[model samples]
Target chain A: MRKTAEQTAEQTPGHDAPRPVRATQMVLRDTPLPPGARWRRFAVKLVALALIWGVLTEFRLDALYFGVPAILLGAALVFVMPVAPGWRISPAGAVNFALWFAVQSVRGAVDVAQRAFSPAMPLRPGFRSYAPDLPGGAPRVMFLNTITLLPGTLSAEVAGDEVIVHMLDTRADLEADLGALEARIAALFGLNVKSRGST
Target chain B: MPDLITFISAALIAAGAVFFIAGTVGLLRFPDTYCRLHALTKADGLGLALIALGIALTASSFGEVFRIALIWFFVAVASATGGHLIATHARRVDRAEGKEGS
Candidate 1:
């Protein structure tokens, strides 16, 4: 099922890449969650949910009556659900990415604000397709989300390996920006960075 | 110290409001849907971050601060996702109308 869908996606013409329908199919076809990982996820989620409940209820002891069962149910749902492959986040890389994202978000906002306030409204908007080196999963989704927060780029669609980006200014060097972001994301996810070929 | 904190918080929040105004203006004035998505996502993301930081500073308890941070995190995710969805829909509509890369 997955093989045929991917082949069809690849064969489709460039101008009209079909909307991605693989996520639900993947969920259906996914292997059973490993016992160790399942327990680990349950434990972590239980603790996190407990903490959130404590905060929400201001840590009243009486609230435990409701919170305990609710939290247990919520965390146990993880066991029954198909686990999407998890990304192993690097702590140092996450800190670095967060700092970079914060700075770039400010720059992105300023860039748009300037254009918005300008009398001439200088915008050279166009779509450019990029083939990401990152695999089709969490890393690619993160990269796409990050593009919207970066300076002058918004991800319009993702058809297979190709992501169509809408640029506020077509003159900007998009390859450099996207490449830098992909590298940062790769580091964060502890994945090997691959050099992207020319699109 | 409290006075200084208050002043800083007020300043940050005011700065955030300015960005929100800029974002709204861009949404109104931009020539097309894609450009407007750029304006909405970037400006509003930063604007909310600044505002949330300012509010976190003023929060009375650590729990309150954590809650504020969580709110900011969820908003950031939602805004990014929403922007992408809107852009995808607009692109599809345009493509259907035989407009490519406007």
Candidate 2:
């Protein structure tokens, strides 16, 4: 599998086709921004900036003098950057993902701690490659990034469609975990990703 | 209520400290670099997160609480990314050396 991946990487020459790139660029460069969407982005960014300023200044009324222009400058930064089409976020899905992530993070930490503190060290560390079903772009990048934080799994590299993951225990059903995470992330982005069968 | 909050905060902070110690133990005792990375990333990330949560509970203002939460989030991201980079480099070196898992 590594040889095949390296061969494909060579064929691509200038780029590794499936490797994840900055998703922000995809958001802005995918298509020309619509006027209404552009205005909405500006408004949202302005509100977020204002809220940040409010927090930093601890709601000082006098600080509004400097805060307003600072907000404008922050919004201008967003405007100058690439804005991807369909930037709408699913708030409900996001909340669910956050809850799930928190739970998993805690579980992962506990599991590792248990292994670390055990008298008889029980670890079968190994590397495996998985072909991600998520389409190339932000979703893939998100998947790769999210996997690293999960329990017992670390993504070594994302070459083309295959992500090489290092596992603390080879016995664990990592592909299933990856599938569940993929589905949750896809729901957050409102993207439809086909589920791959667990190995 | 103040007493209860203080107790909870102390307990959480102590628990976080325990995790940090466990991570350090694993770093010293684990057989390989990859195993150590697992220990460092997961345990340290959770330790910092628990500490942040404990601190946020006693925060004087909503903004201060949010700041604590933001710090935890950043820590989580940084630890994960940092761990991945180290693990990748280690794996590459292992492969170059024709060690196991190559």
Candidate 3:
């Protein structure tokens, strides 16, 4: 990671000094949750675990007692992981995200399918680095995850704010697609993105 | 009506099969690891989702449909995360070998 980070830093024109990649990006590291939110997340997670229990047990009511302690333990484990700070998801934005995600997944699949079946196998795959405007942590992670599912793009690595992506077709405007997806993700997280036009 | 439902489910399942086949072919034939990862992730993700949808359509109860949806959701998450990890690892290996710019 350090080596790649150095490579990434060197590849960029302005980044002369090699900095620790993901030094500030904490993935389950150190974001203290409020008491109320903590409890709420615990309860919600417990219920989710319970639902999984129900499914696995075929909704047998008798299994609830056995699953209770496990559920509680599982829910408690969530608090230990580093979480995004003050992360709040808008319900409508989430719905939009889901819809867009589904559509994009199909598009990605169809695009690959077409390319895979083509006789010429016209593929000009390459890598490009993108600096997203969203704040570090979950938002960026989510963006990278989404890129993998989107058509013609895969996030090869994420170091600090710079995401190195591999594109299936170099001719395609990947930065534009990343920008659009980043905006959607920002809206979903309700993050106030700075320098809207520059991205 | 039941026949129509069966026909739709069958079509969806067949379509899912086609996507899966494409994904496997891409996995085998693609030039590089990153490109193959693209093929595998995208095709398998959609193929599994479509298969799940077909199963949901044919499910006898709402609970069964919900279960199928849950399975599909998990598959989607796993594929996305797994694909990212593989691609990142591949990139790291490539850079380590001093074979940059692919």
Maximum-lDDT candidate: 1
| lDDT over C-alpha atoms for residue A171 of model 1 | 95
Candidate number with greatest DockQ: 1
Q: How well is each residue in B1-102 modelled by candidate 2, as lDDT tens digits?
A: 999999999999999999999899889888988788888888888898888888988989998998887788778878877877787667656655667753
lDDT of 3 by residue, B1-94 (tens): 9999999999999999999999999998899999999999999888988888888888998778877888888888888889888887776666
Single-chain TM-score of chain A, each candidate: 0.79, 0.72, 0.78
Clashing pairs in 3: A28-A82, A29-A82
Better of 2 and 3 by DockQ: 3
List model 3 lDDT by residue over A13-98, tens digit each. Answer: 33433223343444434466666887787788888898887777788878878888888889999778756555678888899998
Clashing pairs in 2: A27-A83, A27-A84, A28-A83, A28-A84
| lDDT for each residue of candidate 2 in A1-199, tens digit (9 for 90 to 100) | 4568778766643344333353334434456756787678788989988887888889899999999998998887866765555444588989999899989888888988999999987899888888876654466667877887788888876554578888889999988898899899888888777878976
lDDT of 1 at A65: 98
The interface root-mean-square deviations, each candidate in sequence, come to: 3.3, 3.8, 4.9
Candidate with better DockQ, 1 vs 3:
1
Output the lDDT of residue B30, model 3: 94
Would you list the C-alpha lDDT of every candidate in the order shown? 0.86, 0.79, 0.82
- CAPRI quality level assigned to candidate 3 from its DockQ score: medium
| Native-to-model Cα distance after best TM-score fit, residue A19 in candidate 1, in Å | 2.5
Local error of candidate 3 at residue A115 (angstroms): 0.8
- For candidate 2, the docking band is medium
Write down the worst ten-residue block by lDDT for model 3 chain A: A13-22
Report how far residue A144 has shifted in candidate 2, in Å. 2.1
Relative to the unseen true structure, what is the C-alpha lDDT of residue B68 in candidate 1, on a scale of 0 to 100? Answer: 95
